[model samples]
Target chain A: MGKRFTLYTTIFLLIGIGLAPVLYMFIRSLFVDGGFSLRNYETLFQSDREWRLLFNSLSLAGATTLITVLLGVPLGTLFAKTDLPLKRFFTILFVIPLLVPSYILAIAWFYCLGRSGIVAMIFNADVGILTSNLLFGFAGTLFVMVSALLPVVIILTITYLRMVNPNLEEAAMLYGPWTTVLRKITIPLITPGIALAGLIVFILTLGEFGVPSFLRFDVYPVESFTQFSAFYNFNTATAAAIPLGLITLVVLIIERFFLRKKTFIFRTMGSEKKMLVVPLGKSKPFFMVAVSILVFILVIIPLCILIHKSVSISAYTEAFIRSIGSIMRSLVYASIGATCLVVFGFFLGYILARKAIRLFYAVDSIAIFLFALPGAVIGIGLSGLWNTPGTNFIYASMCIIIFGYIAQYTALGERIMAATFSHVPHSMEEAAQNVGAGWFRRLSGILIPLAKRGMVATWFIGFIFCLRDIGITMMVYPPAHDTLPVRIFTLMANSPEDVISAMCVIMIMITLLPLGGLGLVKRYIK
Target chain B: MVAKMIVKIDNVSKSYNKHSVIKAISLDIEKGERVVILGPSGCGKTTLLRIVAGFIHPNQGKVIIDGNVVADNGKCIIEPENRQVGMVFQDLALWPHMSNYKNLEFGLKAKKIPKMETRKRIDEIFEKVQMTQFKNVYPGELSGGQQQRIALARALVMQPKILLMDEPLSSLDADLSLTLRKEILRLQEELAITLIYVTHDREEAFSLASRIVVMESGKIQKTGTVSEITAYLSGL
Candidate 1:
């Protein structure tokens, strides 16, 4: 295919499957009784309870952002730029919670802290009851959200830190101690990346649905989901989601204007020096103990609780018997969704990184904007745009969930692929073109071959995201075709705790299958 | 007459993962001398320079800087900052985030040099380097030649007893390298600083060094005056 045709087709699909539905929802939200109106929004914000919900959303987002950045920066620097031992093991351990869904973590925390929990078995019933009370509130939600999103900041920080030319830090070290050099030179350079991480966490927490809803917190996204699913009020759902959408847009706009050139660039120009690590010397053991303690408290305890809860063979047998189809569905749907996301994301990423079109920046902003919007909004928007009789094929079938995945997660693939594509020298394409190769030929023979590892990584990330995704999948799965995550949510109400915990364990294992497989493949390749 | 000894490396050696990069090589530098260590790439010239500057500790032996044992056996007894050494790295690691003025002010401020003196020193260095007009400009905005000059100025503004240059002009074109070499020679004379430079350029060494040390395979092959090294290389 020609460049222009392929690009326009990508744009059309992006709009058709993603933007158009959202635009339709916004338009429908503006009209009531066949006249243009703002009454849905007015009704949404008029009540004191709604304001309290807004407060809850803002506080949760704000607190998550603040604590994650505060904790993430030092931890990232420790892992990336210091002589802390077992760095790789610690990195993988810390990132495990991120791969699991947030609500699964909430369930794990609930099992550990609920009345009939491990504390009751080990300590006493009263302590378990008090801990249960603590776990079912804002504090619990914030803790889980922090655990889920903290990896985002650390990964970004490590990336930014690796790109910094070590000579700069070395130069600073000549005049001052490592602490001063870090404070004055290293942190200042990577602050833009830190800001970007903070922005992402804030938007994610603001739009988070699964954690708050499971914990019974009154956040705006939960209200949006409750309104649409409970009352089937599409207008009020869209109205309730508007604030998060607007907040995402506004935050994204500021991020684009300020951090676009800084945070997203794959390489720093002219500073391709290697990283230098600080020798911890006598403090090595101190820092090692500190990090191990942190990992134990944050990642190990909850996971151990889940494992302990699901120790019975009957729980696994019953869980597998009930949800075997959903597990298989999760695998199949996630695979298909991941493949589709990567292909479309490749072209969209090409536009963003290479600026193939004049409006390339706008294309990038739109994808990310959609990604950052609460997944519930995208789900409702997909349903509203497709639920009509003419579109029952999509609304009533598996296509709806896949479409929701594309609309919500194309940005993840797009962002990752854009970074991958940016590192391939554009001159290679120019040389191929000079030799009479067409755009499609150059892409297939050169770009795709060169970025094979990156594409694999992008696909893996997409699969993991789709597998653990509850926000979009829960909102839009067909009546009888629920994925494992959505099944977990639906089953949580009346099912035995052991069954839920077993399913959760199954969820984590299925997600880790690809990771472990990829690791083995990489070792085999080596 | 013998000059005062400023830097002495006593049987220093360094290795990475049991692969030796610097063997038992020893050298000494008197105050106010321009000594150039010339060698091929991967011959441990840069490693030895880093050892003397207290950035790297040799596996065996000590480094004495200005009459103090800054590094002994495998420990840096005195840190790099307290050793009063200024360096122009091979990559010219000028702070890209800061303007030239801030770059010049950084070392002085770290040493707790007073604000009035910091301003005075930066102004003096900027004037000396003919970069006064561009003091407020960042390093990225400057040309290759201009950044080289700023790197030199950043090092010199510390007013240290010793200066180390690790092929600071290798990235520039021949003409700019020659120009910066002459500038470096002039500043070394005016400041009467002990200059320890490492490079592979024979002509750069012959032109700038009062004494030359030729090294290969992590050992010193010869140490002599410029003309003697010229003869040694010619015979080789």
Candidate 2:
């Protein structure tokens, strides 16, 4: 009875924590003169600017997705298939961008490309297409996000490609033409993977707040911000989120409809065989040089500039000192958020993996739905939800930002923990019980100790993710408050490139400590 | 006429959804009896053992132990923790996380045995299993034979009345399996515990059990002494 009651408690607590904001949004949307109405949504779509905003957001997301897949699929294939020199070195380069936030990349790119940008001075004339109108509005925002997120697309595609046996490509080599092999055999096998990458990128781009906002684009997030800032109209902002939610829902439905059954069997089967290295041959040098330059310009240069910006002497030493305090506060908030995410995520993972817990599938989907929603929407929903009468418990507190962190990153923790849990057999626990060990003892003394590496990883990843996030935290930040990423954003508007550069270096260094600690812990535990 | 019943099963059955796996069957294990359930692949021998271990509940009937109805169609009464049985899985299922010492101490603490007593019992089990030299080593660090030994010691530390093994030696090599089989037999004799062992190996069943239950398609084909079961197998 106690066990059953605990399960119910876990379930309700999760629903309350996760769904409260979305529910509040719904309630607030309906809160019209003590009655419910769809007027909030109606007001949102009624204006010309709102329609343009919707189109801009949709087009930007669509363009980002298309551009990312174009760059990512080829790069993923090249990374997976070729025996290019320094394969290990390149793999690290490919994944490092994912560790940096898109907004940071946006700031860095803007820093290097703005009128007083380093590139402008270095060239001593109008240099690249960026100096033209390409780096300003929709195209600029779309281009920056693509450059940042293409690595994510590459990583996801690589995971899929890794699952496909290189033997299949090798199998084709003996008979079909190379183009045919690529078009027919290789592409079909990795189609689902490509689709998955594209879908994830689309969803992420749709929800993206940082890059678009920095570009001064009038997208949904920006418009939502305007509505919130100008009119304090929670309803109109939530109405904006309704469209964002529909976009996410549509992606979810489309993915489910097409890929549901296929994913299960594909993942279970594992990769067919080790990659048969497709010799890059004559094209190797050109491809290597080209990719090397792209990576340097896109990732490294911007990061280097940010590090420079952060350390440069400025007029206001006190504001710089206060920035240190802001960094600390951000760290505390993110750490708390990460811990909460990992704990709830671990419990959710345990339940899903146990199979004995009914409603495992439903809970899994709900968790994922919240995860898939844009940070902007979650921020909007949460702000709208809490700003209402009688919800003062969390409205202006650090708890709101922390809640957003959990809602966004809990899926990552669950994924890591569940993968680890499934590897440890259920029979092991049964065996412990059969030997007279009670449930709690068996779990603490045995199961948890065994899964320590995964546990540490869950916390570490969650922490880093929270640390880098600006999208949701920006919306919920109280006046005069600043997280590292938020500070980085503020610097984008006012401070010199080197100051922002210094802050980025600081942020990355701080995040890497725990990541390194996780590695050490994994080794010790193992 | 016979010894006291350590465990009882009354017409217990189980299945997955529509497919009946273990049909209505009843059995009793007397105190200190060494019984082997032998079967071909796909038989319900494993399921029957799992039900007795309290990992799974029977679709019908009851499982009673020491005059208490632990499980019944009316309502299952006892949890696996309270059943006082020790199981060794086909995969060994050694707690890969813990050192050998911790694994042995787990069951003792769960029983709320005194700290000194738990430590003493662990040392004794380690010595008995010849694992004192490797007590600090985790399961991953140990050889298969060593891991199997740790599992047995961990189980035995609980001082269970019944020891259930479900093809515990199936994963080991021939030499390891044979050696471990001898160790199990010796341990059972020393402990004077009831044993309900499940396996599909003919020679293992022949060598281990005083009595053998041969099963097929979730029903017992025959049950008797090993010699009697061999005679039954040969005749079929």
Candidate 3:
């Protein structure tokens, strides 16, 4: 009985803290001037411009999804199944784009191909084709967004590919060619994974704010930000965000339906069999060249452009000196947010993994829904909930930003924890129970020690996400207390090109520090 | 009448990172013979069976199935498909996404059998196994004994010249294992196919084998009839 009470209390606390802002926004949308009203929503729908913004967002997301799948599927297959040269290096190169902020990619592309870019200066001619309006609009947004999001598809596809029973392929091999076996058996088995990855990319692209805002394209998230920050109309901003949240919910429902009855536990007890590597034969060179070009476009060119533009060390030093406060604030806030997220996520993940509490699946789904929500929408919700006169402490402090990070990223930590917990046999816990160990004792002695690696990974990922976030922080950050991303976004419009480039370089360095440290630690452990 | 050889393993050896799992083993299987290779776990029984099935290449020898060389000295000279062999894995390895009927039909389709003939074979096998009622069900939906029947039916439906079983009934309870062992014996007799069964259970090996080959530490210790194996065990 005490355990049940504790479980319910934890659930309610998580929901209250994580989802209050969205709920507040929903209630606020239904009321105005202390009376029940839908006037804001009605007005939002009545505008054709709003419909255009919605169309733009959907189209961009669709284009990004298509391009991401086209690039990611073949690449994922190559990495997972073939003996590609320097495979590990290429995998890391492909994933770097995802780690770097999307807006930074947008900025890098602009520096490389904008109206007065290096290409125009090099040719001593007007490169109108390269500098056309397309570079600042849909085409540019599609390019940057696909580059930023393709890693999600590749990584998820590789994971699913690894999980496929190799014996299935060997069994098929007993009656057919490898090609026929893969086509008839392997692809069909992994189609669900590919589709899910594509859907996730689609939703992420729809919610993306930074790239579109930088590339001068008008999407709903950017419009929502404008409604709140530019027009100071909280009602319109909240109303604008509702459609996005609803669309995301519908997609989440579709995902759940598609994944129904499928066991998603990542098995850890089985013998670690190496996946069969198909020799690429003469096509190896072709793949190598193609991959090299891809790496050049995705990773090399962006960093080169940033380095070229930030040639002045004085500019870098000045920018670092000026934004040191925001930089420190970002690290501190992200660390706190990541720690809280991992702790709460461990409890929620344990509940869902063990089915410890009734209706816990609903809690899991809600967390996922919150994670998938657009950052701008989350920002609007948080402001609507906490920006009132009575909530001055939270609204005027860093807690709101940290709260936003927790709400958006706890799902990631929960998933990692759940996967880790699923691998731990229940009999071990039962054995501890038989020994008279209480819940806390079992958790600390057994579960936490076993899941320490997963917890650390969750914390690292949550930290990176919180550090890279711009849209939510932009909306909820207290006045005069900006994070690096917020500072970069605010300064982009007015700062000199060199200073901004230097700041982007600094941002990239800071991002890579933890990742590089992790790499070193892994090597030492090995 | 001359006895025809269905499988020939000549000087086969295999190693993983210099630790030999199969050391210079040789065996010959005749058509319609139930030859059970009995050994403890990690004793190379599965590896030897896999070599005959063309799933693994021998490091220093040749595997010829029905007069055609399938693998030679670490090279798969002819791939598994052309060898016309069916294997039942220890885990059953039934494709969870496929129905029992579809699973049986997959090999036939891969072999390019005609659609009508494929249906006919599948129906006949399902009827023989008394699993026709469960043909539309997935492997996950079936009972363990039912899944065992379906796995056997899937292997038999291919109509391969040779059938290999690797502890396929190890996971079931004692009663179920006994029943399935009897069913498999009955099927082997009815189909008149070559059989290479691997297991560590002494009773299972004795019950299923026309001739039993005892092995330990990657070397065959004895090869004889079931009574001979029993006598050897009694002497030990």
Candidate 4:
């Protein structure tokens, strides 16, 4: 009916679904034996062990950002600015790790480097043991995290490079060589973008529990998850998470106050045909060989290992037979979660893009803060808030997991849809209003139709995030109701390597299906 | 007492995907003269200017600047930097991250101009453009007309053998464009460098050009003195 009423109601529902549980958990943590206390957060940085873990978390995140930036900048430059052959193909090849979960990549690495793995089969047992030792510690964890988060930097770099006005480079060229122009103009211009990428990588790597836990790296998120899952100690778990929450808060503050405005320009920033394509010339062969070696090492070998290990029909069949129910539930729940996220994201993004209300900033901040918070933290918070008998329908059923997905992934949809909605002219809505059309009429007739492709893309992303999600889902999943990623995780320890590989392969393929479908849908929607 | 040619484009042609942008266009720019290539958007005037500036390699042509074969037969014989030219792009294309002073100093440092010389040139150029107060200000913080002046100063500070301007004042308001046009005219008079400016506006060409080359569909239809070009347009 009324626009404000509808908008406020929807936002209220979002707060209820997403923000309320976390707040409820925080409040519950403050009370011990019916007396208010800081008992949960009292030991936030108390001991040497806590300091070590904090160092571990910060160093992992910092190293991941460093390595990914070092690698991604060059690769992103090659793709965005150069006439490198098969640039598109190389881009997709590099992006493969982004589509697959980082933990899955870790698992694949383990199979290839373990004591009885490919290294042993190819070389010798001692070499295999050496590699396995390297693979199971900080080195292994850093490698997996770098590969996983590398795409963020590369994508961001390419996006930022496109925003560099080609004319600027040409003007610089009048004074010096391509190298000079790049140094003097292009790199300096995109420095803000690079910093944003670094911030994102650090935050992501900080909150990451999956890869670190798989590689046996002692980190904050893993510590939080262990405190909850191993000890069943909610106070320590929440306490462990508080440090991460504070870090995320600091990061969010930086992003909102300093970076968000700069980042928004990227939505409008893109390269056109007029932007110069750098000719690689004689150096082309050298770059090609280098890129090929990296591709072979990073992408090809692990993929071949997976295919080689799990090529049997029996493995696929067993994978299917054992996890078919989990796969089906993951699909249904992700679909429902994605649908809910899209609906909520649409309204939130509208408020943001149009600045419909002053509280849009607060809503956006909370959404991003939740998204940036470790999934384990959200999972623990959800369980603490809803595990009572009165809320057993939510706690015991799959609804709590869905709630986790919505809370954790809504920002993905919101930010993307906000970018999409910013492209739509406000005049169209005003014109519809001038014609005496109501809000719903204007929305259905103008906004939705214009924004259909972005909505689909948003839903697809939401679906992918919800599907691959383990941190949130693992903590809250009821008995016998695990999703595919959760099932893959549970099976990793006890199942046959071949079956586990097959399950991972199936999960990857399932993730890719929507990608292909989205491509087709986008191609035709215009 | 004939004019000395400082730049020559011989049978230059460029096409992208078989859609010809510049079709075997040839032009000569004389030393210390203002030549305006006037046409509507997409008439390849800017592309031709870019070719002379050594940014784009022609498919079948040779570009000679001051008796040096800068580009020939789809190959860049001398790179853009070595061409001894400067350009003020249509969008100004000022390096946004750098201060206005650094923007002016960049080309000098690239050429390994001595540090004191770079500073002196920057000061002289900024002072000439009356932008000394904004030496520390970035391009993004400047107004449209101020940035235009800075762009002009950036190009002119190099004291190039040739200067290319591609509709640098088109984005500014009418009053600002008028003022900047006069400023450009005064600078050309004072500096006496060869100028090849591109603009779709005939009035801009008339005011800024000693000679006008009228182009259509990448082909130059008329090239003469400004009065002759005006008469040619009247006949058309």
> Residue A400 lDDT in model 4?
95
Per-prediction TM-score to the true structure, in the order listed: 0.69, 0.92, 0.69, 0.68
Better candidate number, 2 or 3, judged by lDDT: 3
Q: Write out the backbone clash pairs for model 4.
A: none
Q: Could you give candidate 2's per-residue lDDT for residues A1-526 as a string of tens digits?
A: 5545555666676676667787777677776767878777777668888899889889988898998899888888788777778766666666665666777777777767776677777885467445734677887788788877887778877777777666667778889866678778776777788888888788888888888887788788777766766687778777887788888888888887897667765667566467556678888999899789877876778777776556545623533564787788778987898888777777778777786477887777777788888787788777766765687668777878888888788778877888889888888888777777766676677678867777877877788789888778888877656687887777657765556666666667777777667668769979
Error of 3 at B14 (Å): 51
lDDT of each: 0.87, 0.79, 0.84, 0.85
Point out the higher-scoring one by lDDT: 1 or 3.
1
Predicted model 4 interface RMSD: 22.1
Which run of 10 residues does model 1 chain B get worst, by summed lDDT?
Answer: B103-112
Q: Kindly list the per-residue Cα lDDT of model 2 for residues B159-222, writing each as its tens digit.
A: 8888888898888889988998999899999889899999999999999999899999989889
3 versus 4: better TM-score goes to? 3
Kindly indicate the candidate among 2 and 4 with the higher TM-score.
2
How is the predicted docking of candidate 4 categorized under the CAPRI scheme?
A: incorrect
Candidate 1's C-alpha runs over 4 A off are A261-270, B1-236
lDDT of 1 by residue, A342-450 (tens): 9878888888788888898778877898899899989889989999999999899999999988888899888888888887776445323322345676577557876
What is the docking quality class of candidate 1? incorrect
Candidate 4's C-alpha runs over 4 A off are: A261-273, A521-526, B1-236
Better of 3 and 4 by lDDT: 4
Candidates 1 onward: DockQ, in order: 0.01, 0.72, 0.01, 0.01
